[model samples]
Target: MIINKILNVDDYYYDVFMSISESLTGFSVNELQSTGLADIYYKHILGQIEAATFIEFLNTSKTILENSYSQDQLNNAINAEIIADPGMQDMANNIITMWYLGTWEGAYVNDLSYKEGLVWNIMHAHPPGAKQPGFKSWGVKPVNSNS
Candidate 1:
């Protein structure tokens, strides 16, 4: 439960990850000997930080970036666009989300802003220094996907 409390701030995302990890690896607070949910939460957070760093590195090279319907949809869109697949539009949105709410830097610096959790609102938040992406879809999915 200690891990749960620590992750409380981000329960919407991390809880699901915990459930799945527990199911797959059979790791729990008792088994891991974490002090509390915070320990568990932070451990996962560290992993996510590493993954996000890798993602930021990959995204920095893009000429354009788009927004995400939700944070989870981000990776799929990016992969789709990289291959020049039809999903490029969605990927563009994900890049835009990272640029604004996330992190991205490369050959050319582009800043972006989006209202939290919406594709179109992100464009509206665009700071003066950032380039605006032109994705048509503006629908926002709820932050938590689990019931």
Candidate 2:
């Protein structure tokens, strides 16, 4: 159930991978792509999962991406199908795990994954050892923090 794959993978499914990730993670394609980790995550998924299984998953979700109107629409569409099957929903969660924590099944993919984890993006903070702030960065209010 645990495996790995990632990018530099410019084949048929790579685009779908990114698109689905955007829908699932609530991050724009540009934001996800800018991390330079898309290829790595894509490759990781391919390695961990059977080719046919992974391909079928992507194909099943591709229409959701094409017809997406907003977050709710995409979420509803994905949930209506994936959540109907617990196994499919698990795979969807695993994909989210790969993006948010940069690991699949609690295993670290690479150092870059840590630095570029979507959790930091969501928090509007740099990852642990990334984007080092200059002196006194902490003295000021957090950029995205309400406090």
Best by lDDT: 2
lDDT of 2 by residue, 78-146 (tens): 988776778778888998988888889899789888888889877878875666767888798887666
- How many residue pairs of model 2 clash at the backbone? 13
Q: Locate the minimum summed-lDDT window of 10 residues in model 2.
A: 1-10
How does model 1 score by TM-score? Answer: 0.21
Model 1: per-residue Cα lDDT over 39-147, one tens digit each:
3333433444454542333343232123545435544444544435534333333334332243222221212122221223323443333444346534543344354
- Model 1 CA deviation exceeding 4 Å by range: 1-10, 28-44, 47-147
Candidate 1 local Cα displacement, residue 84, angstroms: 22
lDDT (Cα) of model 2: 0.80
